[model samples]
Target: MFFILLSLFIARVTAEAAAGGEESALLRLSDVPAAQAFIDSSEVTVIGFFETDESRGYKEFLAAVKQIESLSVAVCSEEEVWTKYNITSDTISIFRKADVHQKHLQLSETKKVDSDGLVRFFTINDIHYITEYNQASAVGLFQSEVKTHLLLMSNRDMSDFNQLKERLRALAPKYTGKMLFVLVNGNARVLEYFKLRSRDLPRIAIYDADSDRKWLMPKGEISAERVQNFCDSYLSGDLQKQNEAETSEDKTEL
Candidate 1:
């Protein structure tokens, strides 16, 4: 009789603990103060609200979020999060250090910068790292050099593909050794860009050598010049240093 009573008590305790765990796991956007406090204190916070079971896109987005360091992510209904943030649209919010929030806000209004320009930015969409099979056989050697890693497909058109390639090539020299480039997918705007632009080029893949991860660039008509300008304005300092180092090495060989 005593053992039966003890068993029931243990079961009750276990059930309560499980219930508490579930509650803690939930990120209640209604608790705005707590959410804001977490964002202010953490070095980086990533907030995403989307329907889980119905959103194939969100699943991939979550995978990318996992790759970032010191990033806090919460998945919930769009309506809930929008209500909490007092905004409309299902979007991702990234918060950096509290000290820089005001400055970042100011900069954000002036111009849209590159990834290196800010402490963090939304990827815009999921990345699709392509394999060799998706590449063009005619440019096999160049593909091999790039490792034929990831490809962006915004639409069925070929112009977008060319634009993406040109942009990546221009940007590659800038981030040669420092930061890795990320390609986003599933954006309607990006797809529309590709549909209206070039449509004959083969699909290409973007790779991250450090992590060995691949991301496909979204199909779009992004100008190579624009990409280059963006990189030059934001990443010129780092690229210049890398170029200098290479020049020094050549001189040593001489």
Candidate 2:
């Protein structure tokens, strides 16, 4: 009897959720403070600033938000709130805390605002503080204004995987505009490209996409202080000088 009651409760909750989903999935914001709070509530959030539910591109924005279930999307029809975010007219904007980037899609300028285009826009700009490296995200990561990347390479199966990621995530904010923190997990192709082996389970490397240069951190325990120092040394030009010295030595030996 107890098990039957539990099943019924689950069914009822599911039914209610399904009913609620028929309405707008967007979290509605009525004022400036509420809009700011929603934007600050997540690492990434999309807010469609529309004058009304019938505004151009509003429906397509909702459909795109639904298609990308991972995204947090909201709606604001208040013109006063729009001024706070610099939304002059119907716009779909994405706010990313990672690099403090605010990307806007001005409906007036778009040739055609459709669900597919919105989805593509979101995917291309879905960069986070610690973005996991993958084909879909590669486009955004490479195109990011921050060309230097601090790569944390590891496999998910590693015992200390989550801890390692947390260490990087915590360090990411300090280097916000200077570097992008990327997590490369179990991508053997990437490992091979970097001349790394599985035995090198957890490692750190700095890759400058602009220069197409990579520097591997000397093998050691991965700690926050050590990683921070590594970044500092690179930014200070110490790493480049050291690399040049080493390269010169290699040529002399040859």
Q: What's the lDDT for all of these models?
A: 0.40, 0.84
TM-scores for candidates 1 onward, in order: 0.29, 0.85
As a whole number from 0 to 100, the lDDT of residue 200 in candidate 2 is: 85
- Residue 2 in candidate 2 has what lDDT? 51
Global Cα RMSD, each model: 17.5, 7.7
Candidate 1 lDDT by residue in tens digits, 1-254: 45444543443343344434333333434234445554554444566544442433444444455455344555445354457665443444555331122111222243443333222343211111211122232132122223322333343344455456445644554443233333434444433434433343333334433344433233344555544443453334554455467789999999
lDDT of 2 at 185: 95
Best by lDDT: 2
Give the per-residue Cα lDDT of candidate 1 at 106. 28
Q: Which parts of model 1 are misplaced by more than 4 Å?
A: 1-30, 51-53, 78-81, 98-254
Candidate 2 residue 42 Cα shift, in angstroms, is 1.4
